[model samples]
Target: MNLKTFLRGIHLREEKELAEKSAIRRVLPEGEMVYPLSQHIGAPAKPVVAPGDRVLMGQQIAEPDGMISAGICSSVSGTVKKIEPRMTVMGETRDAIVIENDGQYTPAEGFGAKRDYKSLSPDEIRTIIRDAGIVGMGGAGFPTAVKLTPKNPESIDTVIINGAECEPYLTSDHRLMLERPDELIEGLRVMLRLFPKAKGVIGIENNKPDAIKLLSEKLSGDPQISVQPLKTKYPQGGERMLIHAVTGRDIHSKMLPADAGCIVQNVATAIAVYQAVCCSTPLITRVMTVSGDGVNTPCNLEVYVGVSHQKVLEAAGGLNCEPEKLISGGPMMGTALYTLDVPVQKTSASILAFAHDPVAANPSTPCIHCGRCVSVCPVHLVPQMMQVAADFDDFERFEKLHGMECIECGCCTAACPAHRTLTQSFKYGKASVNRLRREAKAAAAKD
Candidate 1:
């Protein structure tokens, strides 16, 4: 098989062996579950259920506030204990719905029935997905229904299913591919139906040969879909990177996948789409990998969205030792957690606990003028220069250098021999640039 890959991504110690072999196990929370309303990138969902209201599993507890937002559903059947601000995985407090579990997983009315998807129109499919509160399960948390209804739907000619699972120690998508290939393929078909001229492609990292082979064999008879094995590299699962690897299309900084005539969906998101359309199921539970040196037994667990991190760790047999640090996703790009009381949101892919700090204890030093950061930047940006601009508060130079193009993948920081926090600096600079833009817009409006 020909191995395809994007340009300039670093290869790190995969460390996937910790949980890659473990099959996804279902773990139910024994305590209250907290569902944050602002799980996705858009406006927070508006709460429809108040304190004392009973909600069944898959019931809509919150509705989308705008076209950019996604609805929020109850993952377990129970009475709403409270609708108040709660801590989330991102280390911030947000409005969340707390449900006291009744121990009975009762399905909501109009759920649990399979429908003939072929009979449904594209609009109907989009509506079902929107109502189900589905988003990009791959961690971006972009509303899936909004992505399917692009302005120029006719221009989309291909749909790419990302099975790269490139983030180290995260095996949730890999396990899904190996265990539920048929459902994933069905989901891909459902996505293709939204764009009449589109064909489907599944891009898997060459590292997961079993998934590639299984999906290829399962999709053999289908003419509309094919599988391609991508080179194993960090951030290869990124939308633009995967798009380039599969279709050889370059999406400029301000452009989207649709601009290149493609729509990329994560492998797990595909399964969620299938469930939403076929089984009348809403986005509730998701498969998440909990692993690292600090874990007693690292494994992939099918976790409900609102479960607490502490509950998840306990279910994984509790921590084996004192954790030096806890991260929400992969080490490279995942957010560090300040507390274990935070609830898992829709985009929580993995919860990593390390006994020792993964980074070297050495202090960050001055840039050695090495071009390593430039060499490994997948987006072709000069990290050293970007960091310099950010340091001096040179917003003009930063904007001119396309600092916003940085995907925050941490490749530059990893490649920096001097241990500069290039990615972190870029993140700060991007925020500053964005604030300036918003100020300018506001001034223009005032005039």
Candidate 2:
């Protein structure tokens, strides 16, 4: 098979053996569940239930506050304990809805009833997704409803399902694809009905040959949708790179996939869409990988959205020892988890507990101007130059260098001999630039 890929990416040890073969296991929470209101990328959800109110499993607990926000649903039947500030995976406190689990797992009215997608209209499908609180699920957590209804729906010619689970030690999506290929295809069909002219494309990294072959065979005899295998590489699943590899189209930071006549959805997100639209199941539970050498058992588990990290770790058979580091996602772009006291949100992907910290042991040295960082950059940005501009707080120079285009994939840092914090600096620089813009707008408004 001819493998497709984008330009300029580094290959690392996949390290997927830890949990790739483990089938997804469902784990119920032991105690109270905490649902953070701000699970998606936009505004935080607003609480619809008050304290002491009874809520059922799959019941809407929070509603979308802004046009860009996503609603929140309860994963288990319980009483609303309170709405208070709670610590999340980001290591910050945010308003969250807490529920005391009654252990009944009682479903709301009409939950889990199967429906025929052919009978539903495009608008009804979108509404079902929005109400179910479905988001990117790959990690971005962008609301799926808004992404499907882009500015020019007619112009979209390709709908890409991202089966490229490129991140190391993450296999939730892989398991989902292999276990439920037909459901995934059905989910794609739902989206395809929304755009009449668009053809569906499923992009999978060749490393997962089983998934690729399974999905390819499942999609056989179907002209509207096809499977495309991609060369395994770091950040191959990055929205821009994936778009380019599958469609041979390039989109910059300012352009959405819709602008390039494409729409990309994650593998797990597709399954969630299928369950939501066809089975009347909301986005309450999702499969996540809990792996790393520090854990007693590294396996993929279908965890509920509001389950506490402590509960998740316990379900993994507890830790083997004190981990040197804990990450909320995968190694490449995952966030450093300061504590296990936080609750899992819709955006949570993996919980990695490392026995040792490799990066910390390799102390940073000065840049040697080897230009290796530039060679590995998926977006082709100069990390050395961007680092200098960021160090000097030169936002203008950074902007000129297309700093915003950097996907923060950590390719530069991994490829760098000096072990410099390229991704971290770029994140800081971008935050500073955005802060300045906000300040300027505020000042202008006052004037």
Candidate 3:
């Protein structure tokens, strides 16, 4: 296991054997299941079941509102079929809900229990991960109880976990770390009892040597857990470069990682927080990775979280060709999709596609200042001076040269040799500095 490397990133082309020896499989739920209502990242869950309601499967049709909200179940059992807008996965349009399918997925009351996750409690596993609306399925849906709400909770210490699934045709967190490494080490000992003076590690990346030998043989003798391995690079599972490549620390620039003592998380968000706290289940189904080159039979499914994306490319055996662009989560921070009737949520891990080339690959020239976008910046910032201060509008010297800690992770438009979209000009200079900080907080709340 000679892995431990990290320092700068990029090494692309790991199309990940299309679907890394496929296996997850079980999707079923096509005639409806939209849900949306702003999948995580705070303040959205408000529906509470509507349109001819009837719901069931893990119930709770949206509720949480304050403390960094998150709650929304009902991954199919019946009716609803109407909450509104649609589209999502950042293509826009919002609201969702939908539902419909009555092919009876039934099961809802205290969902699939098999508890004794060492007798729960860290406030009963953060209220079953805030009522099983679990977020952070690792594409940044955030709000997994606001990363276990640690605002100075005694300055954490360490937890990491990220399994460094360094993206490139994502293998749904390396097949959920080679098929649930002991339910992600029992959800990393239930998030180490919510920061009991932390210490957990588990990084994993030496190209998944059988998921670091099955989580170093289920963290044998676990001296407060350890694993490590890493070095597979490319946004090395981010969260501040996996807490500076596992514990060398450097979290700063508007801090987090619980202010550098650490927290990180994501080995499929610790096995979806151990199936949302000991199998009560909710976050409607995840584990995607259907792979690219316009898929023919690339695998990894366990989908459901609102299915579609062309029913996971017809369960991965349909379009062996006709693709020309259709991402969703892994082609380096995936997204570019306009169709496949969008759906999957809880931060879908990979749906790709890309085939087109009727010949027209030209425009993308200027930007030869050649620092290879500041030598493959993995947050070293200066993405060519934040895309030349966002093409000259100079957003206050591009937010004083930090430019919102650019985690756009397109790695300076893939180390531009002048194919400079430079991460879409720092994503339109961070959407014109968050629309001028929401119009200066709506003119200071109208005085």
Candidate 4:
């Protein structure tokens, strides 16, 4: 089938064979799960249960403060071990609720026995989703309900579901599409009805022909629905990148997809929305891919939130060789794990370990004044110039070059023949600028 190709993306070696052929299994680890209060993007959840208190599975342990926040719940029947600071995906320690599993699996009262979503109004649908604690499962962890209620309704005409698992070694989304295609379509239909004016599109890369074929066949009769197969490329799954690929529109620096008359969601988030709205299931468990050359057995697994990285690695048959580096998500955008004790959260797509010398093969050398970084940048920014400014600690020059606009997709770094750490330098530069802004605000407050 002819696919609707997108502009400007690189194709890295997809080591999906490690987990692509395998199915998602369950990680039945019994112990204390370090459930962080701030799993979503907004304000951190305020705990309702104390250390001595007991909680059943699916019980709302924390309530939402605002519309942009999702509620928090216990994933297992356990006693509150403690509520203390713990390491998170963003690599900072924060307040977390620890629960000790009792092995009973006692679910909270009236967990799934709720009214059907069809009976509810559009506002009611949003309330149900917010109440169930559903967020963007695609790693951004933004509140789902907020996305549904567009601030500027006049701008949006499309709601795109990102099925493009462009990052290598991540097959959780793919497995989800194969296992839960019907549920996905049902969720999409619900979304289309919610956004009456906007058309619904499911964007999948050509690499996953089976998913495209299956989903397209399912959505055939629906006039408002169409399946667009994107060319297999890196960063195609990004909101801005995917939007550009599917709609030929570029989201501005200070705006969201909704600003461009579009709101994109991950395929996993859509299925979760279906379960939350239709099936009345809370966001407790998420599918994750455990793969890399370091692992002996690689496969996708449904892991309860707060389960440690150590447990997941063990489930993947432990490491074959001592890994050079361990990442919380995929290699490209995933954070380097400082400790394996960091529990898996909603945004986690994969746990990657590199045993072989992938980085050692090409060590960083001096930039050869090549224009490759500028040419390959998907957002059309001069990454090389920004890197130079950052290296010299010239904050003025760095900020002037639209350094903050850089998505840090690593395309510039990946394409550099000199193997320069352009992404890392840019990240530091951005952080420094943010810090300066914060300090300025503090000084203004004092004045």
Choose the strongest candidate by lDDT.
2
Model 3 lDDT per residue over 214-317, tens place: 77877878889889898887888888888887777776558777878788878887888888787778678888888777788888888778877788788888
lDDT of 4 by residue, 385-426 (tens): 999898898888998999988888888888899999999999
> Against the unseen true structure, what C-alpha lDDT does each candidate score?
0.92, 0.93, 0.80, 0.85
Candidate 4 yields a Cα-based lDDT of 0.85
Better of 3 and 4 by TM-score: 4
lDDT for 10 in candidate 3 is 86
Residue 34 alpha-carbon offset, candidate 3, angstroms = 8.1
**Per-model TM against the reference:** 0.98, 0.99, 0.34, 0.96
Ranking by TM-score: 2, 1, 4, 3
Candidate 1 lDDT by residue in tens digits, 57-81: 9999999999999999998999999
Of the two candidates 2 and 4, the one with more favorable TM-score, higher being better, is 2
In candidate 1, which residue ranges exceed 4 Å CA deviation? none
Writing each residue's lDDT as its tens digit, candidate 2 over 316-343 gives 9999999999999889999999899899
**Range of the 10 consecutive residues with the lowest summed lDDT in candidate 2:** 23-32
User: What TM-score number comes out for model 2?
Assistant: 0.99
Candidate 3 lowest-lDDT run of ten: 356-365
Residue 387 error for model 1, in Å? 0.1
TM-score of 3: 0.34
